[model samples]
Target: MHAERLYPILLLLGSNIFMTFAWYGHLKYKSSPLMIAIAVSWGIALFEYCLQVPANRLGSAVYSAPQLKGMQEVITLLVFAGFSAWYLGEPLKWNHWAGFGLIVVAAWLIFLD
Candidate 1:
């Protein structure tokens, strides 16, 4: 059960990475027209959804749909925070950390039995 749960979480992490890049990497390609950027990002996001769908289906065997969705939302924020700090070269300020801490607490509350 634990391993099964971990599978979807890992997939969600990978999907989030691809998604973050697809959605925001366009900023680095500002010279491209908006339509071109949207097209490219949409192409990349297709793969994200590919992994995400199966992840949720597999995850549903162990967790309720709402639970899986909640988990994915939390992971999305976490992945975005790391990607922004590392890839985007944004400074992770104290307030950002504090906000993430609150999000973690919220996740914990949601997952609590």
Candidate 2:
């Protein structure tokens, strides 16, 4: 990938990580009130969109909308994998990796010319 493409992809990847945490990290904090968790999630999600939107816009010059969406999905899944292992203290087994690989293959198909 070109340097420009790499930056946007990195931005998207980072944004997805924030978004995944915002959306699902609350599961680990079950002791917190539902409303409180929702509020906190929304706060974090705002930051996610801040980066996500720019990443999409920058990537748009080099990729189509569907390609950008596919890239976002792939990055989201990758971020969720790391978040699961770290924040959720969950282990990723071979099957999980295989499933992710399949999803990446789908992303490639979506982005292919």
Candidate 3:
């Protein structure tokens, strides 16, 4: 694939990394105040949007809205899985894989012409 198509995927990957951290990194600090967690998550989410907005805009040129959404959902799960295991030390189980596999199939269906 050309750079134009590839760029969005890269941006999405980067965005998902930040997105995962923003949404769930707070879990590691449960003893902290909820207000502080929300504030910190908001800060991190700002960076996520920085990449996400551009990714969607650039990807729109090459992919449909549903395709972009599908891609983002799949990317989000993949990033979350890694972040969950590595950062939180919580490994995924068979059920998670089964569900995620179905999502991959759904994405494949979305991509069909």
Candidate 4:
């Protein structure tokens, strides 16, 4: 694929890494004050948005909105699966894989002409 296509995927992947941490990394710090957790998450989310906005804008030049969203969903699932298992100590059950597979199928359909 061309750089135009690959660049957005790379940006989206980086953004999702930040997003997953912002959204769920706090589970490890549950003992912290709610305000503190929220503040840190917001700080991290700022970085996520910084990348996410540009990714969508650049990706839009080549991909439809639906395609971008489908890509984001798939990336999110893949990132979250790793994050949950490694950081959160949560093992994915069989059903989780099955559900993710179904979503992958949906993403494949979205990319089909």
What residue runs in model 3 are displaced by over 4 Å at the alpha carbon? none
Q: What is the per-residue lDDT of model 1 for residues 11-93, given as tens digits with 9 covering 90 to 100? A: 98889888998999888778999999999999999989998998998998898877887788789888888888887888578
| Backbone collisions counted per model | 0, 0, 0, 0
Model 4 weakest 10-residue run by lDDT: 104-113
Model 1, residue 14: displacement in angstroms?
A: 1.0
- Give the candidate number with the greatest TM-score: 3
Which lDDT value does model 3 have at 71?
Answer: 96
Report the lDDT of model 4 for residue 93.
Answer: 98
State each model's CA lDDT, in order: 0.86, 0.89, 0.95, 0.97
Better of 3 and 4 by lDDT: 4
* Deviation from truth (RMSD, Å), model 4: 0.7
- State the lDDT of candidate 4 residue by residue for 1-113, as single tens digits: 99999999999999999999999999998899999999999999999999999999999999999999999999999999999999999979999999999999998899999
In candidate 4, the residue pairs with backbone N, CA or C atoms under 3 Å apart (3 or more residues apart, or in different chains) clash, namely: none
- Residue 18 Cα positional deviation in candidate 2, in Å, after optimal superposition: 0.9
Which candidate has the highest lDDT of all?
4
**Between 1 and 2, whose TM-score is larger?**
2
Q: List residue ranges in candidate 4 displaced over 4 A.
A: none
Write candidate 3's Cα lDDT for 8-95 as tens digits: 9999999999989989999999999999999999999999999999999999999999999999989998999999999999989999
TM-score of each: 0.90, 0.91, 0.98, 0.97
